[model samples]
Target: MGSDYSKDNCVHKPPMDERNLQGLKDYLINYNLPDGHEGYINILLYGMVAAGKTSIINTFFSALDPDGRTVTCVPTGMDPNSLTLELKTYKLAKLKFWDTAGWNAMLKSHVKPKELLRMILEGRIPIGTNLQNFKPTFPEEYPVIPGNAIHGVAFIFDMTTMDNISGNIMLRFQELQTIAAQICGHRVVIGTKFEKLGINEKNHAWIYEYKPLQQKFEQLSASTGLNKQCMFVVSNQWNGEHITMIKRILALYALENMIRNIDRSLKMTA
Candidate 1:
């Protein structure tokens, strides 16, 4: 086996092809915290407006249960100024997800977004603590529990529109990583709309070899100040009642990687 046993020439189907999809999906369904205390693996997701966080999340449900319909973990098409309330928590398979309100740019936090993110990791901000209604009287202080607090953080970006991300936002994401490493040592960079690359949509296995996706990964890794290894991309077939099997596996693979990254915070190597 010479470095993945495929050498560097394997393109059409590399190590991360359909072979690992079902395994990854099964792993998540059966996954549990290594500590064995049974706690939700809280992971925080952040990004700009229309970054495809909700779409990517819903797609995960479709991946997990291909025979079933997708679930709205976080409300999509949000109107922050409107009276609609956010879900208290997007809990599934003991993985709890938290996302910011869709009204304003995450960079537009009442305080710097990193500070707010810090508040989340430390477990100070409770569920439903929307930035639009921030008040000193609310959100009683608390400590980061193994199951309750945000143990990992992931930044979402639109794969189709990554070129348009501003330098300032990139810098902000970099700054946030400082807090992530210190708090939980878990951080993921996700690119949504992977199918938008110039490659054929059905050729999902060629993702790593495809020139356009490879370039986008390089660009995002460089811009976000994260390692290319920490980056993952997925196609968003969120609206489809029935997704192709390859796409389902790809989505589950992305979800599994994100969870495994969170597990690092809980001291799991794999």
Candidate 2:
């Protein structure tokens, strides 16, 4: 089911500024590594199944490619079983995007929140490790103390299935919030598939233009203690004449949130 809003009432805006886009590109390219840290800034992406996390990463890379090449470095699919069965990391210059298996509420028995937090926070989970029936690995198992702690976490949600935001989902999200609070990293929510809600593709103002949609997320943020500004809605599957601009806009918002989280993390560590 979709929202009750109609297309006539929707708002629209001009395309994103070229200057701002360039600034974000430069920021990601020239991000400073913290003292004694040689690796890229680790940004963890997590969400339920079919939330389009992988597509978001691909879209980001496509936007950054000057040759306009479509980059699908990470594998992505719609399998109900987690497509990303491992802790995969994609590096773009100074930024490292880590994509984990989709969190299944049905598998809560095997994937407890605390254990998942440990795997993410300490980077203890081994690559290609399936989360189904998964056992938590202790920190001592590592030869050296894993220091690739995430500087930011992005929770991608399927906006088309907002009605399916069950109690189980909210509970898990709350657990993530608790972990982020403890680790001093920032959390942002990205709502994908705006087209499913009948949102016009050319309407650039859809991010915060629709009051009802904004209110729904605002209430969720209030309950989950997520920063209201961290929520963004975009169409990851938009394909048409203006596909490039749409993807670029989506990438801009995604990177903007990532940068905000990174800055927040640095301040907390300082």
Candidate 3:
């Protein structure tokens, strides 16, 4: 096992265009949403608190938005409790990004997690409503509208928590993916807080060669029941302040996978 990790990288070619972050950003910015019954594509970010879903959104805008500045377009932090208290939507680069309250496995059944998630997935839950376990938050007149439904999902897992996440939590994550796959048809697992894994700017270009990431993939596979092929690692803006060039490029690489997967799902259904 040591030799395998120490040997050549599993990924021969990295997906990132280090020199062309701007160009990549430009291409995605101009990219059109594939024709669908829905007026726009809605991608939901789901994970535990501190999973970095919000940061991922900030990462996308930081790297892709024309402003060329790092800003907290979305609030994020390291607290285990969710910073996002509501189901909210942010307009970005031709898609609707939904940032919902992080999963809390401890909810003792005021509203079951899967049941609430189903409500969210079907667009039955009202945006801007506080995500809660105290009661149902569905809209009284929310008819099944394609425009309001989720188009894709990013199942984010904090690299720091994958190995030790409780069995119950892992089960919830898997269930979330199962529900998401039923709706989106394709999936991407994002392992955030990846910067802690010994990858640095000098070597991030050759991320595929990093042995730790491969091991991390195994951990994710065990936890999420998703394979490495569909998983992408990202380290969002550190301390919610400086967004390094390396972080920007890596986040872009993950976004590219997500956009491509969304496009593929669209084609398969077409």
Candidate 4:
């Protein structure tokens, strides 16, 4: 199905210009690295299965690619199961986006919250670990040191299915947020599948201006202690039209938030 709104029908926000993109790239290139580490800014994207994390990565690259060709560095599909089994990292200049296996209630046993927290904090996980037959490994067993730790975490959510944020989901979010806070990293929530929300181009602004949607995110932000500005509503489905612009805007917002968080951490420590 196509998006309910088109770029022409919505309020126009300036796209991320080349200058801004280059500036962000340069900033990340010189971003501070932990002692004895040799990695640049690494952002972790985590969310439920089929929440469009991979799609967001692909769309973000597509927006930045000068040739306007969509890049599929990470595999994306509508599979009921998580397509990503191991930790996969996608790099753009000095910024690296680490895509991990989707979090689902059914696979909690295979990939527990604590295990995921350890992987994120240490920034390394056993290669080729799938949901089935996955075993939590001790640090001794996985002696590999990560080049960098996660600087920011983005939680992707499918807005179409967000009618009820169950207690289990909230608990998972809280757990992840606690880990992020302990490491001085930041967390942002990205809501996808916006097209299914019945918002068209004429009222696309409502996505942000509407009180109900804003309140829902605000409640989540309050519960998780994330900055209110960290919440974003995005549509990553490429409908071969103005949806591309929408995706670009969302990607730009997400990147800006990540950069802001990293800068805040640096300032706090400095």
| Model 4 Cα shift for residue 87 (angstroms) | 1.3
Name the regions of candidate 4 deviating beyond 4 angstroms.
1-38, 79-82, 105-107, 126-128, 202-206, 241-243, 267-270
Give the range where candidate 4 is weakest over 10 consecutive residues by summed lDDT: 3-12
Model 2 per-residue lDDT tens digits across residues 199-257:
56555444456656666576667657876667776556645433455557657666766
RMSD of each: 4.9, 4.3, 3.4, 5.3
Between candidates 3 and 4, which one is better according to TM-score? 3
| Highest lDDT against the true fold, candidate | 3
Model 3 whole-model lDDT (C-alpha atoms): 0.71
Per residue, candidate 3 scores C-alpha lDDT tens digits across 163-253 of 7878877777788778776766557788887667766656666665678788888777776677777887776746444566666777777
Record all residue pairs in model 2 with backbone atoms less than 3 Å apart, i.e. clashing. none
Model 1 C-alpha lDDT per residue in residues 1-270, reported as the tens digit of each score: 112123243322424545576677679888888774467777776676787766666677767774746555545555554232232456678777676654235444455666666777777766676665554343344444445566676778888887886676667767877777788657787778776665565556556666666677778777767877777776665445666667777667667777876676567543
lDDT for residue 195 in candidate 4, whole number 0-100 = 67
- In terms of lDDT, which candidate is stronger, 2 or 3? 3
For all predicted structures, in order, the TM-scores are 0.81, 0.82, 0.85, 0.77
lDDT by candidate, in order shown: 0.65, 0.67, 0.71, 0.65
lDDT for position 260 in model 3: 76
Model 2, runs deviating above 4 Å: 1-15, 34-36, 78-82, 105-111, 137-139, 142-147, 240-242, 267-270
**Candidate 1: residue 238 Cα off by (Å):** 4.8
